[model samples]
Target: MMICEINSHSLPVRPRPVQGEATIGFLMRVALANGYETPRQLWIGLRTFDAVCKALCLSAEEENTLFGPFPSYWGHNDFKYGLTAADFNHSLMRWCPLCLRESAHLRGQWMLKLCCVCSRHSIRLLDRCPICGSTQRLERANFDRCICGAWFANAQYVDTDVESVVRITQTLEASIFDKVALPSLPSLSAQEWLRLISYLGQFSETFQPAKPGKIANTHQLDTAMSLMFNIGWLLDSWPENFHVILETIQRKEAAKLSIRRTFGSMYRVLYVDLAEGCFQFLRDEFERYLHEYWRGVVSKRNKAFKPETVATHPRVTLKQAAQKTGVAPAIVSHIMQSELIPYGLVDLPSGRKVRSIHKSNLAQIKALMNGCMAIGEAATLLALPECRVRELISSGIITPLISRVHDKSAAWLIAKQQVQRLFFTSSEPRNVFSAITVRRLLKYWHLRDGEFMALVQALSESRLVPVALQSTPVSLGNVTLDEQEARKWLEEVRFQVGSSMSVDEAAKRLCLKQQVVYDLVRRGLLVTIEDKLPGRRVMRTSLEDFQATYISLAEFSRSLQRAPRWVLKKLHVPPISGPLIDGSRQYFFRRSDVCSEALRVD
Candidate 1:
């Protein structure tokens, strides 16, 4: 028939193309209008539907709009738009009975993987014939009739809560057509949204419960949609809520194993363009779970550092050696400075000379340097003044393996075990006190100056033996104690008092200022007992409590034997209730916190 004659003979009941209708669906409608038995019959040849459109008096733009694939129809180049012929299944066409009854045609949106529900009727689309349970075919002349001779228009329709489905549809439509600006998710672009949808589909297929074989129908689409909805919520809040989901997933052992088996790693599941924000979130989540959940699965083998054998003298640069040995570059430099490792400047092809160490000597140097400390480091480790350490060295009490620098100074590398041995050997007597205690005892005894001087002179010559002090800095001087014989004489001379004492007595016992004791009481840090005569007296038990619970930050750093900045950086301070002490921002850490931190540092 002539094109003009065919146009005149076109069916009077030609329906307008529905929004987001598939090319196949539109072709089917045109076929029905032109008295064709089926859409396939209207095709002149493979992929040639121009003849049918020309005969029907359809314009080029209208024909292209109705039948063109993605980029032309959806205004995007990506096949993820779900417009290709392969995207639809001729043997398994899904349809909403209510939608078909109202529009008398199928929509292109229904053919997409994302299209799980009918937005108009708020009902799930069915793929199988309701009565016979046979999958519906799309080749039928009429869009509403099933292969089983069932008219789906008369089939019972079930209502559904299509809120998620509606949202998914709107988001997909907005992304595809650039319809509306989604301010909530400003980081997402149209392409990224499309990729996210594609990823959801792939992820659902990978992790979904295994059946006998692959089935592409409403069930698969529903699972993908459900996953997309949940993932959408996760992406909305990102890492915080995402971390919660990961924790939950990790708790279910079976699910965790399934996920690992299916995806292998989180990175595999989230592979996408690095520029995408979703990619970063997924990567961070993956890394977090990698450490927390998949640590056991990861290989822990150390990579050996091997220098190139091409050179006559095989050597590695300081930075390269550091990386290979898993040691910091600064530490490696210190080792070189100490002359523990033989190093020299090597000429590079770039005409620059760089310091390098021979590979053969690295092992011996690393072993010698391991758990060893320098003179200053040893003093800090031993909690003694550097001068005291020097005196001990001079007296041959603490011997060190000294490495001589380039005719400048020697780097004393003391073995940590030796330092520990010497530190623990000289134990301080808990009852022993400094010279201040002798004066207090003399005053308590009501001794006269001449008697005290004669007693002090005698005690200084005989009973006053030097002892290694605890807590106090060496600059303050070593602690001196009365000999065992002198202790018996002192007991007979001075009266023993109860544990609870006055603030002045507490200050002498604690080696702190009386004003400091009063300040502690004022700050509610030190418990005190009320006394009408002495004003307020701090109990000895309260002093002991203060000693046990709190220590000045400086003392804390000394105990740790690390720099003040290092201590502050490592300490994770717990929330405290009250305001800090006035004047200086002097921190007083809980003794328990210090002990725990010490253990961690060690």
Candidate 2:
């Protein structure tokens, strides 16, 4: 249509960029002065004008000031500012009636999500038209009137104490736009304040009442501003004030969940460098609560909040170190106990002691472990009995490079090179075989599986191999075996099957389920002796005594003519005074007690 001269002084309004005016707001003023109907039309016209000019005359800084304000000022690449017409309501634009009446223009500050109340007038910003009860769209034909033909200048206002919010907004703006230091909030720099408010705004949006669209309500805006203000106040006093806030919110479950979720979000956002001054109060509280709640929830999944002891030599706790090394906490503890990786004990202010390792040592630990394998892993790789592997270690044929933790059953780390050397150069011609292979060999030799296993147990108990090199006392279902050695032993020795057997074998002999036998042993009705090779051993006499002296709950119920479930319910309430049977799952009663209780119930 018609072209207007393109200079700041030549424009009709010559409106200077106000302190809080967003670039889009300034563009809106330009469209109005140029007699355009809407901001959308203005955008189209500008694109067409740029085409005619052959090159976009707007400098990079100028274009950024207009459309890039939100993302650029917030310092986040992924955050969408929603400056276009489709996202107009997402920003929750608002205005003060008094300010509009005085200046006859919208300020950029009013477009911010955190700008809820007018600092100058001490009143809440009105986003919806009071007369028609519709959200003011601001794209209307005129500046001071709504789409429904209501004048915003005439809307009612309510008094509010938004001084703190106003101060925070002003401080953030000065710090971000002007690069000025905020002397009042000395603990946080300008960038930190921006990040803090950004987080607060995102959190506040979650509290908004359910609505039809993505736009937030005015009340939601007020709540967000209040939250940000209170957070700013808390920062003045730091961790002490933070604890007070936590105590106050503990009674409110929704608030507590929200705060906990927010802490997790902060951890993700802040990443691994959580220092003393970075959101001092929030960071401290985050770490404290994280330590308390970490076991089942965040400990395994999150690694962002690991505290750094020093800048040059950063240290991580045992749990964190384990996570970095991709191993278990017990393994890390064992490594520290053996002095393989140097570590120190830190006494916390809460009177708790924690073992911490330097981050630089993580690579060293990984390298050391890489060259070695645990005893079980080595056994699997070499296809040898775990017991035979231990024998080699004891005989000094394969010396373990790392020792086990004292009083703990954690496996020792042995150099893989030594094991390989022993396997290749040994005169015995060792043949690594799995349990399946051992079973085949037993079949080939015409020996029964039970009798051969019993002989192996006797050999294990004869103190021929040190306890450290013994096959683990647990089941040998997954154990690797030395086939040549096992074949030689079977050919050389003749052994007798014992009168007693393992719990599983006992269950089969007594014509009862395995769990039933375990229940009897748990309740002290049947006694067991601990054996090094095959774990718990049960005597035939003990099983016979249990069969004679104790009765099942079902039998007891039938004897008393009562329902089994009813009897079980009564027994569970005030539980019997003895060790729990089946870890509190099944309860056993002596036949005499069962008879007396049955009679009493009858």
Candidate 1 local Cα displacement, residue 544, angstroms: 46
Q: How do the residues 1-602 of candidate 1 rate in per-residue lDDT, one tens digit apiece?
A: 33222343344455556556666677667667766666665553312444444445666556545522321221232343334443344344678888777767777666655556676677777877788977665665666776677888777876665465456556655555553333344445445554555543333212433221223452344654665555455554555555664554444333321234433333344542233555454554555554444312221221111122122224566887787777767667766665656776434456754566766767855665587788888777755557656755664455554533322334666655546544221235456443333324443545432444344344445444334445442321222344454444543233233334567766666666677666667777878888654567766567778988887666778876888777766878641212243642445668787777776665
lDDT computed for candidate 2:
0.54
lDDT of 2 by residue, 1-602 (tens): 56544443233443444444555455556566667765555544334423212233445445444422332222232223322322222344578999988877676556655557776786878878778877665453256777677888899998775455666666654554444433433445445564565443332312321221223442345555665666455554554554554443333322221233434443443343333355555555656753433221233234344434122225577888889999768767766765777776544456765677867789876776688888988777656568656755665555565655343555587766655553321122233452334334444555543444443453445411112223333222222355555544543343122345578766765566787777767656678887553678876676667767766666677776789778876652333422353354445566766665654466
**Alpha-carbon error at 287 in model 1, in Å?**
5.8
Cand. 1 Cα-lDDT:
0.54
Deviation from native of the Cα of residue 99 in model 2, angstroms? 2.1
Q: Model 1 — which ten-residue stretch has the worst lDDT?
A: 300-309
Highest TM-score scorer: 1
Q: Provide the overall lDDT of each model, using Cα atoms, as 2-decimal numbers.
A: 0.54, 0.54
